[model samples]
Target chain A: MDVIAGLGQGFLVALDPINLLYCFIGVFIGTLVGVLPGIGPVSAMSLLLPVTLSGTPESGIIMMAGIYYGSMYGGSTTAVLVNIPGEAASVVTCIDGHEMAKRGRAGPALGIAALGSFVAGTFSIVALMLVAPALSRVAVAFGPPEYFSLMVLGLSILSFLTQGSMAKALLMAAVGVVIGLIGLDQINAMPRLTFDRLELVDGIGLIPVVMGLFGVAEILTNIEQQIRRDIVQSRIGSLWPSKEDLKASAGPVARGTVLGFLLGILPGGGAVISSFASYAIEKKLSRTPERFGKGAIEGVAGPESANNAAAGGAFIPLMTLGIPPNVVMALLLGAFVIHGLQPGPLMMSQNPQIFWGIVASMYVGNIMLLVLNMPLIGMWVQVLKAPYKILFPLILMFCIVGVFASGNAVFDVFVMIGTGVLGYLMRKFGYEAAPLVLAFVLGPMLENNLRKSLILSEGTFDIFVVRPISLVCLLIAAALLIAPLLPALRKKREKVALDATD
Target chain B: MMLRRAEFWGGLFWLAIGAFVAWQGWLLELGTLREPGSGFVFFWLGLIIVAFATSIAIGGLRGEGPLLGDLWRGARWRNVLLVVLALIAFGFMFERLGFVICSLALLLFLMTVVDPVRPTISIPVSLIAAVGVWYVLEKMLLVQLPKGTWVEDFIPF
Candidate 1:
């Protein structure tokens, strides 16, 4: 009942002319970024982040969120139409989506993906409106012990779920944590990794690390592979899904929404894992599992829904706790701070308008995205015609301007270049950049919570066990960390995956 | 032989980096707390990297695979060289020529050097992009850009 009222208030906020404008702009830019292969929302947002420093946090945060969710909506276009994934989340969509393209059903594959996404996105937002406040009530009571436990879970889940040997993932995760420790010590106001340079006082900036890893690393890898060979245009026939296609997708969308929402609330690998999980589940439930990698519409429907739901779900932890669940959310946190608003449980109590306003903005953004994306997808297809050579320099310049303007410092521009080089090296060596980006974003928070938790517990480590929420979170983390190790669990999981994919 | 060549070179590089970092670490005051000095982390990470490089060298020497023949497949060294040189030039030109000219030059060089293309099409496109972008960023959006001597008269009010 209360959720309805909150949503009404959100609508009031979102309907405001300025907020609406920002939402539209966010979706427009997001769609543009999402259509281009080798570039994603992270780079787009980072390039624009510094430019938004003048706006109220509400407008800024809403705009960025619009971009994030909007990109999710647009990410599948290239995957289905062009056989290239614009983002990692869209990779699974490519398996069946591209196959569907080759079968001359690209239009239906795309249409169903968009429709499933809209349904899932809207459902999840509604769920967010209802579940967020209740969760916030619980989160408001969290202590440092709980926060620390949550972070540990975050690190462990991120380390374990990534494909490849757990040892390598753990090694990368460790490197990320250590790199994150580079700035300053959260406790006692002492610096741990700064070596005399005055700019080192604030440690390394976030935009640089993120842009370097996801953006520059991508450029390096893509350049190394010369993959721009012309692909034959798949016949893009009807824009509407067939009756059977709709029937097949309906159940997957529903299941994906529920599953994605649940996973999104967790600490790490929320959206990425949810998409993978949804694809796996859809294949398992299908009577024609063999149809999956060979142009199955259900494959695209499930994961697309799941990923959107996961995006919506991510807002829960961020709003409920001051802690951000991922790098994107962390950047949102920075925006919130800039806007003179602090997001946490008390956020609702202090500024209902801003809280409900942002919530309402999501509703507005999702609708704008669906409307904008469906009709203009043809225009988006044209975007693929632009060559990477022409685009690369523009990207580099955007990075420079963005980093420099963030604090109005040239120093950060240097940071962007330095991180770009490091990121390039990492890609060459087969080290993943995402964990490092996540670590850079989460490092300070982890440190702050650990030190604060220790202080709150009066140096007694047992406090982490006393709290039920923290204990449960820790247990989840332990399970995730150990899951890859247990031979039974490993075999079962793989069998489950292979069987589902069969 | 390719992995060996890479690894031998990598080992030498890491060895150099590690020694340099360790030497630098000694100069930084440790502050006596043993909580790990600012330099300590880098020193140790570098040493570990060097050790890993050594192992890679040994593995490569064992010739686990045809490293030489397999080296350049899908490898695009030209792209790296283009980007690296362009960036160094861009970095230096940033303060001197300002963002507009530097970015334009970078865009031009990148299109020409990184990915080979027909210059007849690329040149005019690059110029228009450079000038068009300059107008949008500086004239329309009101971002202050570096004023180059030649473009002082071209600066849009």
Candidate 2:
């Protein structure tokens, strides 16, 4: 009864004329950015963060959340049509989705992807609504030591699961924390790295850093490579999947929803891993495993559903624990801070409107996506054909203007440009920005809790282990840190043997 | 020889930065464990950074990474340089020449010079985007953007 009542109230708020309009705009832009290459949800969200300042918190966050999930729906369009993933999560969709397109089953592929995404998106929201509240209840009991350990666990998981050398990822995270330490120390008023600049005293703005790192950096990288895409030349047969097509996808959709929901709750690589895992699961489960890469409807259905579900699942840690699992969630965390709200356990109790409203709007946004994707698939295909030359300049212009307008400080714009160059170089050197951004946002919180825990126990370091939850978190972090070394050590030994033979 | 590799130089650069941060932290005084000061976290982090950089640099010295030139193998450095310069120029001139003029010029330069698009299309598209964004931010959102010092006196709209 209470949940239903909360949901009812949330729907009322989400359906408000202004909220509805912004939600539409958010999902619409999200879909466009998703369909277009070289522009991702992170860049789009960062570019629009300052603009959201003018609106109510609910509407602003509603739009941002819409962009987050709406992009999931739109990412599949390009993957199915042109074999190009519109976003990272859609990378798995390209394998079999494109094969289906090559077989002239593009329409059915798109339709199944859309339908599966809708089912998974809705499923995840229901799951989030049920699970997040219970998690929050548990999180409410967490002390400073527990929170500190949890943060450690979260960052460890992120660095461990990131697709590169864990050492490099950890190094990036440390660097990010340093960047976050540029302003006045949160505990003491003393400035750590400001160099006595009055501008730096207040701290580096998240907007400028994000705008540079994600927005402008993306443009610089895009400019370096020639933009080329090949669209499917064959006719798209039908918008709806056949009954047998639906029947074939039913099991995959169900399996993917559960698989994705579980994986997405992890700190890093959730969506990518989930989608790939879903594909793998579907293939292993299939009678004809060899048919997977050629043109299996199960492949399209499972990964698409898994990815969408994963996107929804990624929101849980952010909402309940205030720990962002990925960079986009980090930006969203920044948005929450910008609104002067902390996104921890108390958020549900303290800001029920924001919590429930965002949850309810996701439902509305999913319906909107289904409608948009089904009919506007052709339009999205056409939009993908637009030259990158035109889009990059426009994106750059938005970055410049957005950063400048955020604080009416031209200094911030310069900072953005500086960071953008750094971001570009980092990417070129195979360093990921995700860990850096997430760590930067989590840095202050991690330190504050760490100090608080230390103070509580007079710096003995046993408080973390004494607390059951904290002990569990630290154990997990230790495992994550040590887990990758086993395989690496084995490989090194194998290499030594090979060298000896040579 | 290792300096010829991007990873090596990059590692060394970060090492220097880490040392500087650590020195700053030391100057700030690392308090007792029970009552940590503002610099404690940074000091430890800086040390960690130095450790990582050392490994990276050592790895680079063993010729385990790509050459410095490999980073720019197919990159259009001229365009990249021009774009960076344009951005820096825009940042310097943003407050002086105003958002409208500065952005329009930057867009035009990027479109026509850096990558070369047709003048007719680039000019109009740049004009609309620059002006349209300024209008939305200024008029609709009620956010104040810099109107040029010269333009403000001449055009009193």
Best by DockQ: 2
lDDT by residue for model 2 (A353-393), tens: 88889999999999999999999888998898877787788
Candidate 1 Cα errors over 4 Å, as ranges: A229-235, A490-502, B1-73, B139-141, B148-157
For every model in order, the TM-score on chain A comes to: 0.94, 0.95
- Give me the iRMSD of candidate 2, please: 1.1
Alpha-carbon lDDT, every model: 0.74, 0.86
TM-score of each: 0.88, 0.96
Considering summed lDDT, which 10 consecutive residues are worst modelled in model 2 chain A?
A: A493-502
Using lDDT as the measure, the top candidate is 2
B1-157 in candidate 1: lDDT tens per residue? Answer: 4444543453455456556545555554333322434444445544554554555456456653334434456688778767866776776667677666787677777777778668886777767776776677667656665665555677564
- B1-157: candidate 2 lDDT, tens digit per residue: 7778877887887889788878888888888779888888889889998998888878888886789898899887777778888999998888788888998998899899888888988999999999999889889988899998757777555
Instruction: Indicate the residue-level lDDT of B128 in model 1.
Output: 78
True contacts kept of 1: 0.20
